[model samples]
Target: MRKEHEEFVDSFEGQLPPSIIAEIKDTCPASVTKEQLKEIVELTLGLYKHCRVNAGECVGLVSAESIGEPGTQMTLNTFHFAGVSEMNVTTGLPRIIEIFDAQKEIKTPMMEIYMKPSHNDLEKVKKFAIKIKEVVFGDFGAEYVLNIFEQSMTIKLNKALLSERGLSSKDLAAAVKVKSKGFNMEVGNDFLTFVHKGKPEEIRQLYDLREKMRPVKIDGLKGITQVLPVKRGDEYIILTLGTNLEAIFEYPEVDISRTMSNDIHEVYNVLGIEAARQAVINEVFKVIESQGLNIDIRHIMLVSDIMCITGAVKGITRYGVVSEKASVLARASFETPIKHLISAALESETDRLTSVVENVMINQPVPLGTGLPGLITKLK
Candidate 1:
């Protein structure tokens, strides 16, 4: 029975895609006769041929319209991530703009860090989550006392904050001492005293020192602003507010295979351009899905392909994918027409009028679809 299916798949090798062929073979049951399987394959091939786009189709224009039409319905509201009120992510139209523009610095950079099976215990994952949170001095919930007379700054650390971060008073003192110069650190039960060893006339430095202490990162990975251990399915995963892909990948317990950052540029830098391309598609689809729209995936794939065709991710903006067009008129038609025209004129460039926009500007049929072919007649 398996041999019969294999023979059928082999006979339709070039007609059907490898993936479709494999699916048909794998999904067909032994109870189904050879004739039924052949009929199913024939129907699938017919649908595939019918759905395929014709040559010279203006796919770029179609894709733009497909995405833009649905984009009008998207909201401008931000959404709470995974029911975590503390973390709000930009969504709807704004997020779509951010993705398509290929913005380097996003509003809310985040990471979904999956854990290895060996370290996937609830308590262990919780500990791992806290271990990566960026513990700045401000997070300590410390009360500051500034004394100009003695040129001393004292910080009364909250015991709860200390225990949660797994830092002792001595560790805090040592961290402060290492961060600041010419300061004598005295560690007590729940407080640390910093006495400046510099000139007494520099008493104003105490105020500066007090303010500087607020942002001091005493422990944990840098750029990880907040961490939440959330259970997805049967495994516990860590979701972070800020992204630090390089540092996060260094951890042993992290399932590096499945871990990914929401920052597309970070993914490009860390995992290369291919991953960035996939990230673009995924991010765009996520926004569209969240808005309750059901656009075809092929349109999204086409957009991503254009963005990553140059071996680097470029946005759909004038300065990005638009600027790379071969036709001067096509570039001019997009934005800043006078600027593009003047630049081309100054550079002594020629407009071949190869694409749709350029030919349309000249009152000629677009070089696409039925207009793609030229008719030549020999006069008698």
Candidate 2:
């Protein structure tokens, strides 16, 4: 890893106690690869950015939805503090409607709130906002909320320092408050003045206190299965649970008795499907082993079901037919390495048969398969 990346990892690593790290390492068993580590870091940073941008908006939504007249046009903008500072609030009726419509797809609902900051009071306004955010979110057990508030303060400060000479720093600070709330305060004679009325500190504080708790961990895959490759004639195919059966048999053969001897259509027939799926997988492995093919057992188990039964592999769509039951069976059988063994065996058959024999082996789909587009009708 680059020095900066390593530093980031170390810093984040330090957040956990040694006991916790040891426990994680024991349970997960060195499962965090370099790629996964990078992904976790990236995800964390993304969440941080998202939270900074949306925390204030969340407060604004609540405020707008609560106080504004049902049909009235209103725009409210203000800086919010939750340990971290953010510019948030709502916009007019049209903008609110736009936000509502966009929310359905984007999952984020926000509208613009205008703020005109004076020269000097800008810093104070920012500081006050940050303090308010910390107090509010802090009540809800969110320790990191202040980080965004602090960042927002730094941003406003930089802008104030770089603006034109006519805008005094004091004037800038005074402008941070919204005037309609009739809220005012004096920090210093020279620096403190009303630029605009700001939202009540109490209201901001209440909103912060009621904000939802931060999740301890994110949702998604903890890890992914490594892709297993199966050679079929001149090409290779990825062995997944959805692999087709035509990929299996290597030569022309009569319709033979199913290796599995039990009915597998019903959900209660777990033992039957399990038995048959395993038998079919074992047969596939026997075939591949006879051919002296070197491949992973896990891969064979991935597509075991399609190779074993007359049913098309479920989830593995062709052009027309969707194998609902077969797909479900395939998915269920290969939940572990044992079933993965069956899946792997099936894939080997698929590769060998399709490549060498040029025939649809077992459950391989045709144009009549479940994945077909448009209407599929049979002529009498």
Candidate 3:
């Protein structure tokens, strides 16, 4: 460990070009010693570790709070799969009901129907269902059955779908969009979509309703919030939160905590590399400035890497030679904790001295030595 620390110090020293070191020494008057440089590096690394760890916790907290809040909804907009076209249908509650109704007649009821170019046509499928109903129970009977499917698509008083249902915008406190397999919809400015699951008539009705309901405008939605607890399985997964300012205000808990977590996560997503780099630089500079020390910027960069390489916050630890080496050097030069203690003591002494001087100015005897004569010979 000692050898490695020596090598680390040597390597760092070697990196600093002689000219820069000389210039710093010349400018600062106190030459940059190997020990001082090491201390600066170690301090820089420590700061980096602290920032990263805090950043992760901050992100996690924000994600949990955003998802736990009330009044969130998730939209899943979908499109057609590959090698398939022409039978395109928008996803909505009404369409799902229609599909469920058409399948109800079949014994299996859970049959998966594959649609080819013409076969996939939603309008054609609806017509086919209508014809099938007509053959079995006549025109009036077919109409009654179709009406049932249509009625199922209606939104109930509790704000849930009456028919083939999924989560609605109102049911959730916020919406989170996760990227899924094969031609999934991108997170966008509108509602989510899913594949049409029912007959043409039902699909059309759902699409119409979706179109009629204006897209929920999410104003000033800073970003998405995601929470993943440390647990087995999928015990707690709060996926996404919408950026609706009004919704957030109505439920401030979600906005402040959960949404903020997501936003911080998003920050990592958007600028992790840059943030990490800047964090290192900032920390190194702070250590150098605070200690009244002079060190090369590149040395500070090295220290930053040591501290932040793990992207975790950490305090100074003995296992790391940088911290240990720096501490030893600082102790050797300044008598471990003594210099600070002495400085504090000196400050108190100075205050006492000032008080004595003020008393003398007022024609009063100073405390102790001030009032007594320096030469007093006692007659034994």
Candidate 1 or 2, higher lDDT?
1
Q: Compared with the true structure, what per-residue lDDT tens digits does model 1 show for residues 1-380? A: 47867897779988888998888878878788878887988899999999889877889889989999999999999988766778999899999899888888999999999999999999999999988988887667468888877888788889997888777988877666756677777889998788887566586777777767778888898989999999899999998999999999999999998899988889989999999999999998999998899888989999988888898878889999999999899998889999999999999998877788888888998878888765233346
How good is model 2 by TM-score?
A: 0.15
TM-score of 1: 0.87
Candidate 3 weakest ten by summed lDDT: 134-143
Q: Give the TM-score of candidate 3.
A: 0.18
Residue 115 displacement (Å), model 1: 1.0
What's the C-alpha lDDT at position 213 in model 3? 33
Q: Which of 2 and 3 is the better model by TM-score?
A: 3
**What is the C-alpha RMSD, rounded to one decimal, of candidate 2?**
30.9
Most accurate candidate by lDDT:
1
- Report, for every candidate in turn, its global Cα lDDT versus the true structure: 0.87, 0.32, 0.33
On TM-score, the candidate that comes out on top is: 1
Off by over 4 Å in 2: 1-271, 287-292, 308-380
> lDDT score of model 3?
0.33
